[model samples]
Target: MAGTHGIHVHGDVEGSQVVVGDHNVVINAALGSSVSVRSEGPPPTRRRTRPAGRALPDRAPQLLGRDRELAALERWLGQGYPVQVYGPPGTGKSVLLRRYAADAATSGRDVVYLPAAGVPAEDLVQELFHACYETENYKPEPARVRRLMGSVRALLVIDDFQGSTAELAELMDAAPGCDVLLATAERHTWDEGRALRLEGLQEEPALALFGEELRRPLRDEEYEAARRLVTAVRGHPLTLVQAAADTTFEVDEDARVTGLANGLSDAASVLLRLLDALSPLPLSAKLLPILAGGVDKAAITELTSLALIGSSGTGYRTTGRVAHLVAERTGPARDAAKLAPALTAWAAATTATRHDIAAEAPVVCHVLAAAAHARDHAAVCALARTTAPALARSLRWGAWHQVLDLGAAAARALGSAADEAYFRQEEEVRKRALGVVALATAGGALAAGGVIGHIAGTAGHGGAAAGKTGFAAAASNPAAITAAVAALVVGGVFAGLATAGDGQPRARPTPSGQVTSLAATGTRPPDPISTAPRPLTRPPSPSRTSPRPPTKATAPPSPTLITSSPPTDPGQGPVSCPLAGGTLTLGAPAGGEATDDYAWQAFKECDDERTLTVDKTDPDHAAFGVTPTSCPKTAHPGQYIPASGPCVYTVRFHPPQSAEPGTQYQAHVIMRDDWGRLSMKVSVYGTVSAASTAGPSSTGPVVTGAACVCSPVRMPRRTQRF
Candidate 1:
């Protein structure tokens, strides 16, 4: 028979209404039409009710540790708004939502509770319509549905909302004014809707729940253990409740719980299997390996939709939880261990090329290392070999240097001829790589120098020479060349060792008969180097002239010269001479005069054989003169004068002079300052004359006067300036 809107019925069609105590039956005659049946089997009868204590309504158990959830639910109900309680499975979310709905209904608020699990999209809508609308003759027209929802302040509670169809998601979006209370195993994201995450009970409340259930306070250690179990299971309410039930509490010693909360994955696995048995499509075999290979939450969600696995989280974890559960049931520790080895093998089998080798090598090595940690030596070796030859070579080097502790045996196992070849090829490439580096370095140096030279307006030839010499030295030393090559190879290899092989060799060094000279013939001579000069010996004195005698009209020469008494022994002190007239009237010298003085004396003594001469003069005197008077009694005193005296007297004795320029000499002179403050002066002058002539042709008489005088013989002017 055909129903309204061309919906066909194969068996029977009943009017949309059904009474509680009626025989409900119908027969259809034609498509798009319905017939009603009048008749009966025994009149419908109500089943016998058990005594009040014997049976209870099939409502969810009383919610524990859900005060916050209930308050939130009541607030939403009062506002006539929808609420979704989302959390991982076993979080007491469904029970809490139900209790809230019941409470709201008791407060005279309209509330409908529906289980969304296994409900078809159409049936779910129908149920919502039936629960909220009071009329028995109602059809689900969109406008009527809207009008009914708009007229009432009602809360619709949906349990297991994640199991609903996409159409339900649409219905939720369309129902603007209707309030909804939803409980889900996972969080839902709906536009303009709020999702309240229902987490597991906190420590205190959870413990209280246990205390209330068990009729005793939980021991400290047992409470701690429960916390750990809860954390491990991510605090799913069902698991904690089960664990609380299974726990044994004692005084002093904490309660001990086993299994359910302790091994969440295992417990969840049991739940998943039950779900799978009920589900129309069983999880796929291929999916298990993928999930076992460390599938994340998003991947798991997609897998769940495909009936590959079951999950709970908002993202990938829908299938992820199921996979974890499966892993737990299969031996969590063993399953976790197996993952690394499987991943290692997969990576090894897949990554074979050298391109992206550095990138791929690290990933492969990580897998291998993880496998090694899991004690899967075969997998480690398999993955290690999959590493590019260049990378393997580096690994060997690392092993040799003790940087990495790939066991010696394993290192030896990994050492292959291919790796050696790859290393040698790398070294060869490095050697060739230097040519470009050398050229670039040379270019950079030249450019830098050119800039500097331009700024200074002078090029440094020496710098150019140094650069050339460096280039030559680098080319000549095999060790230096090898080191450069090694550095480049190592650097580039780490940067990324391309898959391409080394190119063909270029020109080789050859001996040439025609020699090209590098001699710097036209180069400018280097600057002259000089040493500091030594100090001079005798500096020449300035030429001087004697002052002329003063006329009568001129002031009389000052007679202030006062001579000290001569020594008793003539040789002991400076020779003394009496002035020709009273005191000598000396005047200042005409030109630059010598500022210092010295005195001299000569002595003769009669000895047994003959008169022996004892000359006593200033140690610095040039020469000394002596005159002896005829001895009246055969012992006469010698008349002496200073060697450089103004008076020249005949003398029988002579002394030799040294050839050195600065030798000492002594002389006498009458000196005076024109200014009377320093009147007529009497002093001895020491002259260190240039080396004296050995023989004199003629000698002029020495002038003796009070006026100052220079040496008698006039020589060309010899005034010397410093």
Candidate 2:
């Protein structure tokens, strides 16, 4: 079916196309003999959105009471600086920037916005290039991109930005003249331009969000109680919206989420528990009933009224606080068997495309993993057959690999060697394709084979750690594979890789790929719930260090709280499970002078003596050094015998000469062990002030209820599975 084009060469690329300088990088190997691009299979598709090049993405959520924040963002962009917006979980970080991006686009500004979850940090530059240029898979040379961006001066907005300092540096390099906005739940200490901390809605905005969610103004008696309820949770928007479910809602200061479910109507109760069962997936309304074995219409309506779940694009999902609390209190629907048949049937249906089920893909992956765990061989086979190819085509290579591995494992359980062989062959094709992607992203630094993580003895997606799922072997004559890979790399395939953030990549599989084998399965770290946040003594300051030229944007942070009582481990089924726990807290403040040192300690959270690394310094103009201190390792530096004894580290911050008066300076450092994230961030005010020419000062909304101890919270990092 492949043919060389005439003068036109009519190159067809399976994915979208981006014209490069004389070289056409083809996606999906649809390249003709003449270097070009084209769709590989007869049918090629994309998400159900407007054409991708610089178009405003369609799924912007409605926001209320954010006028000031929006204005501040507007001012920051006006300053032509990069902005970093940080906050706690579920506080509408994505919503704010998304709203801003849409409005700016309507006004005809060149705006590019992308969500950064589930993507490898290394790929940030590639993704940024794609967004700015509306290119399918290519990242033009950096110098070229910078020059283009300088002239374009477009606003670049990246949501859920969790990249490292280096990743960010690369992105800034590519957009020197543009305003960049980065949002994240956790705080990055590096000097990002114009840092804005987005707090929960104040009383006014809270009421607005509540009234809108309720579809009415507060009743005569409802207003006071709503105020108290908002106060109880510090006006966090997600909580306020959930409370709006009952107009006469009282503050549930002591929230017993499990007990609340019992009070719902019969239909509502079932729906509530079902949603809790699918804890993390964003299930669409269309698929919810199917997954719940045909839930009643009233049940969904009831839950919506309760605000137990909210819309996320085409799907619905529970956010931070609700998700954790529910997962803590409930279990999946009575049995996996009850849901298996229905899910499998849905997957077997041929009506949906990648766009149709994009939001539901993660939900599908979760259930597929469950089916394999339940030994529902037939169901696993059915789901994999439909989902794998679609996943691969959408660049969800990680999930596709796992789905195939799960399918092959199911085939083995069903005693079908043929299916297993078929999956392995497809994997070889995937590995070679990945080599091209990895090499292109790496700018040809990596050996082709290094890109394939599932090589024989490495970690396998569906199988054990013994590497049962990778291609059988590297081709004996490497020339053909190398040349082909080289062609794909040179002819240009998608230059960047895209992993599904919500795609629910399969649980890390074991040697046998048996879901039932707990030891064999690898699970991602759970985000612990913080129902009662411990207040810090000092007023919570929203972190904002102005970047020299660019700025960024926000996400919600959940610093772990040590529960007085152990949370009922849902997996234990009625048993109160005791678990080992601790907290990481302050050591000593950094000395005022450039070389003056400071310290922080880990009470009981330190795991095997980890070293501290300076993640970033505000303004990055100053010098800061961090190292594991011999003393002050036991607790907060203040609590120890000597301020620096037995706990954290002795570090120092020296502001860069360019650091000006009236502007504050800060240093951020982080550490991680087996349990969760550990970090220390400190601030030192410039001694002399009054002059304000060099640095950025807050022009955004005043952070309401900003008194929060910005703690080192759980930071989620992704592992490449393909």
Candidate 3:
């Protein structure tokens, strides 16, 4: 005989779970679902209850791409470290934990699955206590909980763990011999614990999984389309599933994007909007809050969960296909404008080296391309202008040109004529300077460079990498030289001087190699009186007669007191600087060096002390091999001229570092006086031939080019009162 009574529990609990205590009890329940109670006399054995709704091990769905994670979890459990599975959303952390829980139950371990999204700590402990002790009321203590958990060999699986990490830590610590597995998108909870970070599946597996979802084998052609679909969703399982399910495996790009975004929460939706607005650029995590307009970690986590954003080591970026979708859905609004100043500031403030620039090129290009496409004129222009210097420093002339073109197009779109013209002019100058491509024949090449310069010339400084003639030879063919000169005139390319400032009035070098002072053109001289030299005069001739008898040798006359220019013989036309006549061949099998002692001495004709400089105003300064150590060292080698006043220089020419077997380098030697005046440009040439095999130190014979004559450059005869 049995008496029936009702037992009531006050607090809310899962309807599927039933509590049983330590006593002999006969209860009729379904075969797969039951709670068996035994008497305390049994050797410390406890009753194991399976919730009515819990799926049997065989009935539970299996997870893909989690084999490694499952094995890792088993290893961690054996080693007694509480394991947490963490990653961006849709990475399958929750599914993995659930799978583990079901497996543990099948293995005879007491399994308690708790969804901890919003549950408080004390409540969680009380619930676990009631579930364990089968009592209505009990004061939960960590020690008691630890002892009780050990007896049952309980395994606690917390899903979507969105509670305080401290609470989670407490539970983990108090569980003693019990194993705790947590699944969370947050990283902090796993900081000191063993964590398995879930990422997307590999290509082959992802496609296979997609095929499995479709319940069919993929055709060969479908493999490529499937691969595109998988890549477009970044190999995310949930995204792949949704994408596959929505379009009947057709994978319409827009529909796939919309489907992926269909069920996002408010925070996630906002994040998606922001990411779309900032399309084509990856931003550092530190700038997220500011650039995303006060978006928080939760929002970013939400987006990451959806696999809309990818995490880089330094920052976050929208996935490529997702970024394209975002750009398509959203126009270039305020967010695009906002990205400009932020990125520009970063480029300016950071000491980003060339390597850094190269590394960040993909991200930079993405942002710039989006901006250009959207016609965000202000943003495009600002970024292009700000990053120009760095690009030039890195020798990225191609990228630099693109930046300028972007600015120009943006300016035109905005109908800002002045801005458009400015950018256009800058572009023209860049093209002229760096874009010079000339044939190797010496007489022809110079003429070719001159003609091209005239056609595309602009008054701006040429960059170091500009005007490169990689290989050239001025063969002693007169017809070739004549043809080259004719080509120069016809090609409309003439080596012209770059203007001093941004089209501002300044002293300029004339074709005759004279400096027309800005003062003469109603502007003040660019240099201060302390630095600029007085006008030059032809020094009087030295007496042909013998020097005064050496009774008391008078100190040598001051260089200024000595007459500078001697009477020109009817034979030689005009006198030239000593550097004019020297030849330097770089890459020659035999190395060579040239020194010009007369570089400084030639300026001693003036009465007042003055500075002499090299005429670096020509855009070809770098092409002509004028550097501080070898020639006049100044900031603007083109404009400032080389060699300080009254200084000597030597140029050592050997094969360029790791020179090719048959390469030639050629350029002119140029110098200037301090009055912003230019001396005649001298020609220097070099060629690299094969090395001699007889000895490592021995080099092959020198291959000479056609002889280049240095004609005396005429200077305006002027007398200075200073």
In lDDT terms, which candidate is top?
A: 2
Candidate 2 TM-score over all chains jointly: 0.50
* Regions of model 3 farther than 4 Å from truth: 1-60, 189-192, 248-255, 259-722
* TM-score of each model, in listed order: 0.31, 0.50, 0.31
For all candidates in order, the CA lDDT equals: 0.33, 0.45, 0.43
Q: Residue-wise lDDT of candidate 2 within 310-383, one digit each (tens)? A: 55554555565554454345444444335656766765577666534433555666777778878888878777
Q: Tell me the tens digit of each residue's lDDT in model 1 across 1-722.
A: 11111111111123222221112222221222222433432122221121011111134556665766676555433323345666554455656765665665555555556555433343445445555544332223332344344443445667665343233443553343456677665444321234465555666665666665555776776777656554554434444444454453321112222232243443344334433332322222323343254334454433343322433211112222333334344332332224444444443444423233332332344344455566655444444444423232222212111112332224435565454443343333222222222332232222222112211221122322332344345444546544543342233111211111111101221221111111111112211111101011111111111222333332222223223233346663221111110001111121111221111111111101112121221232234333323212213222121111111112221234332433323222222111111111122222233333322112211111121111111000111011
- The weakest ten consecutive residues by lDDT in model 1 span 713-722
TM-score of 3: 0.31
* Least accurate 10 contiguous residues by lDDT in model 3: 513-522
By lDDT, is 1 or 2 better?
2
List candidate 2 segments past 4 Å from native.
Answer: 1-68, 78-84, 111-183, 188-196, 203-227, 253-263, 289-297, 323-344, 354-360, 372-378, 405-416, 437-722
Tens digit of lDDT per residue, candidate 3, span 1-722?
Answer: 11112111111112322222222122221211222322321113233453222232222386766677677677545434457776555556666776778777766666766655334454355445545654322232233344454444467777656545445644554544456677666543221235565666767778877887776888897888888776655566766764554434544556656655665666666666666555434565655664566757776775665456755435665654543454344433244544666667666655655435533444454567668877687887777666654443333344556666777788888888877876675565444322221111232233222222211211112211121111112223445545544543222211112222211111221221111221110012222112222222312112112222212121112113212223224342222221112223344353432222222222112111222222233222232334433232333222211123322343333544465655454443434432322332333444555555211212211111111111121121111111
Q: In model 2, how large is the Cα lDDT of residue 561?
A: 24
> Which model scores highest in TM-score?
2
